[model samples]
Target: MTSQFPNTLTPKMVEGIKGFNLCTFLIGLEGWRRGLTLKYYSDINQYSDIHTQGKKLMGRNYSLQSKDKIHYFNQSRGDMVSNEAVRIAQSKQKTKDYLEKGNVNILPSKEFDKTHSDVDIIKLAREIGYPVIIKPTYGSLSKGVMLNLKNDSELTDALKYVRGQLGYSNVILERYFEGADIRVYVVNNVAVAALRREPPKVTGDGESSIEKLINEKNESRKDNPYLAARPIKIDKELKDVLRKNNYKLSSILENGKTIMVKNKSTLTQGVDLYDITDTVPEHVKQLAIDTLNALPNIIHGSIDMLFDGEEAVVLEVNASANISMHMFPTEGQPRSIASFLMDFYFPETKGKSSNHTNMYFDFVDIVNTLKQNYTNYVEVKSLPQPPLYAKKYIVTGEVQNVGYRNWIRRQATKRELHGYTKNLKNGNVVVVVASHEKEKVDKFKRVCKKGSKKSKVSDVKSSDWTKEIKMGFEIKDNITKKKKEVDKKYINELLTELKETQTKLENAKKMQEELRMERDSYKDKLSSIRNSTSWRVTEPVRVIGGLLKGKTKVKN
Candidate 1:
């Protein structure tokens, strides 16, 4: 009934697109879908570095342009968002100070540096009153943020953790506000979406221990693209929550019982974000928009707040909020956060192109190339413009392993096409090619009908293609299994899932056979017992005893 978190993250989860890279991808994809030329670069050599997985990945920069309109971005922070805006959002003290100066309601707080010792910090807390929160003045996101310290003991430990352990010299001590913590996303002065933030928690099903429940939740998180990167870790914060609630990892949480496992509502710690876009009070959303405007050089992004009683108070303004979270909320309908961002940056592209697209550039491959030292920088292949002519050829009969895909790839390359040839799981060769000339696409159908030299083609069925296609033709086979060679993780994920399913099916068959054998043994033992003289001899006595027992319990 109990379990351990194998680990916070899966082996391959963190290696793929994540964090800032993910944010930039979501936005860039939106632009790419809109028929814009989107390119992913390792780094332009004039940006900050993002440290992740032991390697310092320089700014995952990208750009979206169509004609004279172009926008460069370092992750989600676009070039239009000034460095001053980033600095203000990054510093806790500056955020509160600027909001107050703008007459925006903020929690009362005071800031301090290394000059203030532990005793000095505690004295300042007493002056500010109990039930306060203290965090680093600069970094570590929510790791050092401690809320609801009702006494000196909790405050002292919080101070020690942030200052000593975290080594953050400058810290801010603020009165912890009470209410539902939420984040409101404002775009172009519009309160586009709102979501409530809650500490990571799990509801009991009565059959599972708290630990088992946590593991199950973690498994489900692996399915979510946004949640998969961050995990519900069993750390000191989780332990403190369990201790306070008188629950243990082995404790069986009764059905319908919900308990918070982590204090801070951070995605890194498995915090949950629930979309309340449609139902949140209009006034609260307006307040979010006003607070966002209070910050200079920032026209949009998320605003952290607390709905304290009947009113709302701004906690912080995000200059570069991860729009991916809004696009993929844990509950409720997903908002068009990425679309709204596109509208803000490129107003001319509003409602011009279809929302759906099958084509996507390999952003991870670009970053991998940078890390692998293949290149210090990679100028990603530019996406093609719209009004493209596309077609798909499904060639069957001795197609696979006969260089059919390679031949098709060569033919498509010769035609100056942009697409790929792949071997289908059903032993068919599928070639999808696109070009600006419809005549070329129609002409390729005749070439595909002839088939390759070693291939005996039974049929060649062609269809008109409307979905998006990346620029360039390549053959996808065992030679191209590298993650960098693929555009999306969908192919790898599907293959791995299929392999796992096959293994599970084999194991299931073995289990079923074992159970069948066990059932036969039980049947044989029962048959023996029924055929024995003892069973026959006890039959009459057993019937009489049963009759008597039934009469005694009967309520007539």
Candidate 2:
């Protein structure tokens, strides 16, 4: 995920803010930055509910709180949505029924069960028509979905795999939509973000194969926080699409040629999501809002639709839709979906805090402690406002590799400071410490003068540091001045030692083989001598002679 969008985080702020956590943290942090307290918890006891601080929370769910209000969320779903609405959204057939009852335009479609025969399915298909999509009745994220079935054969194969192989007993069939796949995020009857799910594609340079082009595209995409989470996989479906076009990943395309890499476009399909919040027509956004409004207890979410030039058709509505895509699109201006969510939830906090802020909590630690079962919930310290106290101390003298950095790290950690100590090339160590408390920063500066036992600090120069300070204390061995000649010499030494050892082992093995051959030859000669007729006759005579010599003792 190559990141084209601007990053406001500390250069190396906590990672693990990807996947589901990406959306979860974005939405949670958006509110928390507005002077709200945020807490993330696990549902260890799924059947248990919680009453903390006199408020009855459904469970140990993730929540954002203020003095007067607190909103609990199960993933992306907030307390505003009812369980009924959630249930309806979970089922495609039920969602269709709800939307139709609300007079929202739906594509001609029908749901079927396992009882429906192939003939019956074909009959209904003829009535509704060909070139349709067949998907599980309760599928999400494009799983068990077959798009654009042109005839009975295509539909049959799709059904066989999605139903028979995948074990989805119920399915819905709908007309093949001709348009871009668009999702409009609606909140409080207002359109917030609209994104077009573009299929994975590549433009040829007339130099590289399609595979190489895709690799290059991926190289750029891997830096993005959202797009890089799940890279575009070259799977069977993508191969099939290429084969259909008389091409393969290895086939080099003509310069300036662009082709869609896959047929289906969705998050599951590694679609290149583009934020088109501005370009999507006002009507399309309105339709999204209207469709969202039609559902009961559903105030906000993403409405999936397909839009041709003239018409837009609602496909489905996602209740707990992730806002990550909107926040970080592969291309186009990133939409501030978080602000919209915060505005809906805490209207009074609008503009109270700038959205262009860098106040982020330790998302990685909280998630980790939960997984370790350290506790059910880890309440992240609501990050304070910007312009935190920062200080820098460059300790000159016997600081490098003398446990000086580790000692400083311990001191900083004890004081709960945020920053790092790194070794410099000039036999000095740079220690940067930051915190919300000025006294803590000043005390750390004083402590830098007194390093580890072995360190002989000549002078400790202190100054105010203005750079972004990361969330935790660390000792960094950050020298990048590589000694290529020294590395080559070391490698040569190792190779020489290894080659000598290998030769010695090989010679030893050869000697062992020679000894084994000699032993085998002697044993073969002895067996031949024993098996001969003369040796058998001599054996009795030799035994008689031995008895004669021992006659006195044997009394024979």
Candidate 3:
């Protein structure tokens, strides 16, 4: 919604922020509504908040201070500190103190015993009992965690796994909770967003391999900031889950099938964060605020919660929560999280709700939704490049006429770069551009390679040429011949192979079915054998005794 943040910081970081919707959240709703521009103040060495931009425009500053001694510099109002710092500082606490408070609740936790080895963890497990959780003392976002320890062997495995993952010298073990996890975002003693996040689940197609299916899911999340945190790994746990479900990695899953590889709501477990904004009842919101207030130095964080019926337990609180992705929800678009932050930061805006509301509805909301979906919706125009320096970019592969060329044309024109895209007879795409401002041109070329859906660019070559073109950006007519379809002979051969593979698959299914029947038949016989004491003890004992005595004499 807001203009793509200019190259205020390093381009990569800016780009990263843009991709993750971080800058969008920072700007807030009022910023969007008023057409608040993000400008790089050449005067200050650091990034300024909303006020500095206003000062540059109005040729003055709006200053104000609060009871807490935090400063805000503005255009109409000038410098001073505010009371917000005091509020933020009040809610902070040391991680150790927070962990020690676990005794307040029945759930178990411990300080890492510095002198203890893996064996000590085992001893602690025995004392505490089975099915415990092992985690790192200094960790965030479920970085180093393990669950489901049923016995001493499993405890050892969990400890080893946790230690290896964290590379930590010591770790804490706690009781594992069997319930849904919720993250409640609290700001100023009120619950803003209460989300119920679930581990990612997918319907099986009864054809593709599990590994293949996982690849598809992961790739689909390339544009998702949080989903990218989870990487697919095949380990013993994955195998164990398959075995427990009576499935093999080779087994084809049926449609509408769901599988959970990990239990926790961590991104590594492929978490699906649901927007329960409307669903969170009043009591639940109060409970979350109450839980945070109970903890020290814990404002502006997410409460880790597990609820059973009406009862809920607070696992922990995260100070630096990633509100960007959570704000721009995948489903059920709610009020902007940025709106809350802006109003919270500038308390004066509280009384001006009508003004802010008009801006939000009139400008910010609709424009942001559109820009988020398509970055190019707001075109950026570039300044002219001089003859001394002309930038040229050559891109190859299935890029031309597949929407890539059009994208390049738009970006080049916006950034004020002069470029031409053409299709080669060999089907490769070549783009040449000359502009005075090369950085904008370079950015254009970069975006061109990663164009919209359906553009599959493989190779790109860029260079600075002395030659310059006076004309503005233009889209040259470029077309490539389509590849020939498979011949009849090849098609027949492929069909035959497919039929053979299908037949083999059918036979494997039949074999599995037969094995199941045999297993059930053997299970019945074993049940009868266990129940038949007369045959098992009396008959067998007598026969064995007679054979032992008579066989001894017969052998002599």
Candidate 4:
């Protein structure tokens, strides 16, 4: 079944998958599940025939091939996204104009080029009204976005910071709209999900200072998969925001008080996401759908808006790349946007079970594939001979724990062979070698023939190793130390399991106690009702009624 698809696993694919970008990984996973041959092409390694001109390539791009048809993707956005749409989306001014033409409510904005003077910017700001936003026309991740510039002086300084420090040539001034920062993801003219994004903030615990509280919050962010690596930065902008709120890092906040740490709502900048797909108004959803339809050749995109109760104003349209906030939302139900995208890309695969857990590739295999490709790339660039030769050697001798594995690793590394040496359970050492040069593999095998000083090499069996192997040489230990480490790991696992069991037991006991208390309270209520004055007063009536019922039964 695997051989039915084209081999898309290459060196470039490895580099693309090794990053912290969840979107890229998710896309790769989706493609793999959908039966598409996914390949990563790294420009750095000169894989996929990318011209580097002796310069190091620094990034990896992706391609999904379905037989004869192939689709290229960068990040989450794919070939479906038009270059014109991307250009318009990159410019805030263009996005606003497009939204306005579509009858979507948009904050009034004025565009400025590098040639624009500060006076011209201030004039535009005055026209837009006070408390306007100043931001780069073509920027992302909330970088170079300055909110609520009240006066000309503030705008002047912000413009200088954005232009001089941030190096943005184009800028826009728009009326600041304060409300929920919501992002609606639309695919194929349909709104799939929506999320309300909140800027990074901390709640007061009464005891800890604001700075301490922020630090604690940042530490807690490490638990969130999306936020783990990206912590909220403590910078001048944050301090300015605090000062504006009449507080500082040293200020102690009262219990239950909440303070915003950043001015903009950007997930990369630690913004929190709340899935509001089910609750977002139909009109808002329609607005997002309309916004996407307004732009040509945009099969999928995200519409960032500010919902100010009365209306949802389109803030920007992101067509080039957008975060998958709906997938890993901080609150509310997660939406399967990846599945939706896959279905959109391959409509015939819709309704077929593509469970992510069941379709994942082996991590080690991916790493090895990448390594082999990289080795080939380097050999092509630097070595005179092509590097595609590989061999696996199994030696039966006194090789267990005699440092034979390390010796094999040194030998392979010296020849630039990418593979690993492991101690087999049968007291034999298995060494795998992968190289483009045949002599290198033969040389490595010859070196393995003479066992290390502490061991004896009885027989060396060699075979062609055509499978992908890891980069560099690695020594796999099956000695007492490795066993001890494994034992320790199991012990930790057992301890964790015990702790979880204990917690469940405690919760069960607490629940049992609450149930008993409720049962007792109900019993007491029954006893009180039986001993009530109403019961006493109606006792003779009850006796008379019983006698009458008996008489009626006898007559019948």
Q: Each candidate's lDDT (Cα)?
A: 0.76, 0.79, 0.55, 0.72
Best by TM-score: 2
Compute the lDDT of residue 159 as modeled in candidate 2.
84
lDDT of 3 by residue, 287-319 (tens): 667665655544445667776547676666554
Weakest lDDT window of 10 consecutive positions for candidate 3 = 1-10
Candidate 4 to truth, TM: 0.62
Backbone clashes in candidate 3 total 24
lDDT score, residue 59, model 4? 23
- What residue pairs are clashing in model 4? 12-40, 12-42, 13-40, 44-57, 387-436, 388-436, 389-435
User: Higher-TM-score candidate among 1 and 4?
Assistant: 1
Write model 4 residue lDDT over 1-556, tens digit each, in one string: 0011113233322332332245655666666655566665444233332222222222225566667576666667777787687778877887788777888778888888988887888887887788898888878877888877788888888988998898986888889988899999999978999999888888888889988987887787554445555567888878988998999999999999988988877655777778899999999999899989887778898888889766888888887444545655667776766667778876765644332222234333543445565532111112112335778999998988788888877777776777788888888889988766788888777788897889899989999876655445678666697889999999999999999999999999999999999999999999998899998999999999999999999999
Minimal lDDT window, size 10, model 4: 1-10
**What is candidate 2's lDDT per residue for 1-556, written digit by digit as tens?**
3325545444244265765567777777677768788878766234223222112222225777888988877656677887778888889999998899888988989898989876777778888888899888987777887888899998888888888888998999898888888999998888988988878899999999999998888878766777766566898888988999999999999999999898888686667887788888998988998898888889888899999967899999888787878867887777767678778888888875554254456677677777786666767665545447888899998888788888888888888887889998788999988777788889876688878999999898999886555557777765444766677888999999999999999999999999999999999999999999999989989999898889867875
